[model samples]
Target: MGVVIPLEENKNKHASVKPLVDLTKPGMERVNQLILSKAGSDVQMIPEVANHLISSGGKRLRPMLTLASAALFDYQGDADVKLATSVEFMHTATLLHDDVVDESDLRRGKSTARMIWGNQASVLVGDFLLGQAFRMMVDVGSLEALDVLSTAATVIAEGEVLQLSVAKNMETTEDDYLQVIRAKTAALFAAAAEVGPIVAKADKAGRNALKSYGMNLGLAFQLVDDALDYGGKSADLGKNTGDDFREGKITLPVILSYRRGTPAERAFWREAIEGGKSDDAQLEKAMGLITKYSGLSDTIARAVHYGEMARDALAPLPESDWKAALMEVIDFCIERAN
Candidate 1:
């Protein structure tokens, strides 16, 4: 939950995401309480760690997506709250594991779970959270819920493996990159959005609309994430600006830069990605090439493309404020810092 990007940086880097709250609504307050209650508990050590991360304060995007999707279908069940929490729990579990895997030191401006707790504890507690998410789904009592979560979990694992396998490989293609995004980042988002309608037993068209919305929004979010990693405040991004280079992770901007660069620039990228150590000088040179190629702009366009697709995906749903809120969330994905 890295949270130290200065307000100036966020404002300078881009515009703020439009606010979506309809403060007059009762469901919104209930949803917030539900999220808080679901994250509450008595397991001192694990829950403490969980609470530390949860309270570090993200925008609570996943749970919001779940609630919004349910609202689109006019669902009034208490199960939506539980399901939203379940989605957040699953998302948090992935973040814990990801921090350990990435050897990440900071998240949202706070120490990573792996940095605070031992690796073993982090892994085990993450597993515990994952199980709790599943238990919550079971309590929701929908087979569709089980199917969506199980599939999302499987894809997340696959994405992790895919990323690991291709790490530092200069030849990683755009299609391959999208595959990894779909697996790692988008899977849970898709599930979070789709499950609401599924639980409410919405018709096929509505379910598909929500699923498409989540999938596109997730892709857009990850694209922006990769772009920001190269050209963002380290405090805002939670990871170092050149971390992808340091860790040998080949993201879209880097790949595109490599493709568009001069012979020396291409060689530099090859060496950097393939076990070359980069100091500030080399990092600056690499960033210069990325800028020359307008890689950031290209990445933003891609993100915008997905954002539009996400918005278009909502066409089948009946018009409602919740659907509008979901659209705003997608806008936030492309525009948010930290």
Candidate 2:
């Protein structure tokens, strides 16, 4: 319960993605319609599983980034809608597959699809979503966009594999953790933002700017998620506290705590994390070690670093409400860890 990080202390005002939501609402409606239509399958259970997760509360931030980036340039085409939906499908597919891999029972504070229908069903439905995502990418008819997203999809899978390879591995370093997230999370965000400029026919510099913005924003978003897991309200977490510990996943905080702790403390972490003994008591002990070592605060500090990078990424782009909204997204991410 130690939250010593002043993540947004320098900011005088709260940052809200409300402006982004308002800006993208109209486009999001189209994206939502397409999501439902495309999520459908005559197989009945397919839509059931897909819609169950889709309708569950997710910010749809990736898709909105696509829409907002495109709108920033005033692109007048329906292709961005398709691209946005494709971005969402990619994200949804990853979640379904991740739950199966993590053996997670709850997501967004509800029963995971795998929990209800079983793992085999969840994996197949995830594959279904992936197929649909590529189909939409093709329909969008932009090879550049297709290339960007497809490469991201490949990288995401690679990131997941890397994470799996490192599970319960206390030796996992900060750089190793970041590499996994860069591929698993940031790649899609980068692609989602980059393609908007590609489709809008904006210059390469603008595309690069959005891509950089997105990649950094995604990193900031996930680092905060890592911090929140150890020191955030359950409502913000969307899953039970200590799920990461229970799952034995190595995160930055754990890395810092283990590296900085006393020898006996290290032994405790190795037993709980490396030896799979993460009961409630162990969880409390682990959190204590993380706090004593400044793990939570340092993790938030890392998130703040990336949040600054995300903000600076947009500096070269011309100013607009879309740009302002995107900036708010960076702060909103860090402030959540406050």
Candidate 3:
């Protein structure tokens, strides 16, 4: 049987994200306005699809990081708002493209753009968002910030291709999975945090510190997400619990479980994952095997390791409310698994 934890304990664990959300509210309001303004277009379908995803409820964590990191140095300019909006646009564009690439039906607990508008419109709108993001970046007139975010865009694309190459390959290693998440998820996070100090004219050390914190925090966040796919509720995930299994996506839990299972168990995984027999019964069997091999617990342990690295990244920065809030974000990302 899967090890069960108390429901109230899990609820308490996820409460850490709330404070960061509350703290970033004022700056996030400006970011939201810019997001809405930029999402509008002369073409009806363009705004239709873009607004659909934008209106969907996400925590806006990336832009919040941009805002909070700027606040850490007490930046006086309004460029942070524009830059934060750009960061959010980049994120939204990625989600639109990812849903199409994954052929997913749902995202953020709503039907995906592709599901409602078709793949052509979804891809085109995603491209439009990327263009808008770059326009805003150029308006900021910071070549360094532009360079960092643009480079991240390239890395994210490469990461998507890498994940495609490894999809459903049972031999995929833990190292390989780490590279994919670093590029696809953590690269944007590093760039988002790094740009804040650049815009604020903070020293190189401060810039690197936030970047390190974001990178490690992102790794931890995705690791917890991997564990939650097996152990969490759909309400918490904003998608079906077994979506990863149905997609035959190789995640950390699957990697650990596959590596540790017996010959017969490995054979079952091959049939279920590689062979794409991921129906409800197969999903149940997969969960049982994952529980038996302690996959969920091991993945959470990995997340905790990265979370500690994130906390250590902030050790050198002078203490401030922004720094404290960012630290809490690390806790929130890991505790979501509880």
Clashes of each: 7, 0, 0
User: Which residue pairs show backbone clashes in model 3?
Assistant: none
Ranked candidates, highest lDDT first: 2, 3, 1
Decide which is better by TM-score, 1 or 2. Answer: 2
Runs in model 1 with CA error above 4 Å? 1-43
All candidates in order of TM-score, best leading: 2, 3, 1
Q: In candidate 2, how many clashes are counted?
A: 0
The TM-score obtained by model 3 is 0.96
Off by over 4 Å in 2: 7-9
lDDT-better candidate, 1 vs 3? 3
Alpha-carbon TM-score of each model against the true structure: 0.90, 0.98, 0.96
**lDDT accuracy of residue 261 in candidate 3:** 96
By TM-score, the better pick of 1 and 3 is: 3
Model 1 Cα lDDT, one tens digit per residue, 1-338: 22233343232344333345452145556765665666566777877778778778676777777877887887878788778888888888888888888888888888888888878878877887788788888988999888998899999999999999988888889999999999999988899899989877899999989999999999989998988887888767776788777778878989899888889888898888886667778788888888889777787778878888998999767777677667677766777534
Q: Which one wins on lDDT?
A: 2
Candidate lDDT scores, in order, read: 0.79, 0.92, 0.89
TM-score of 1: 0.90
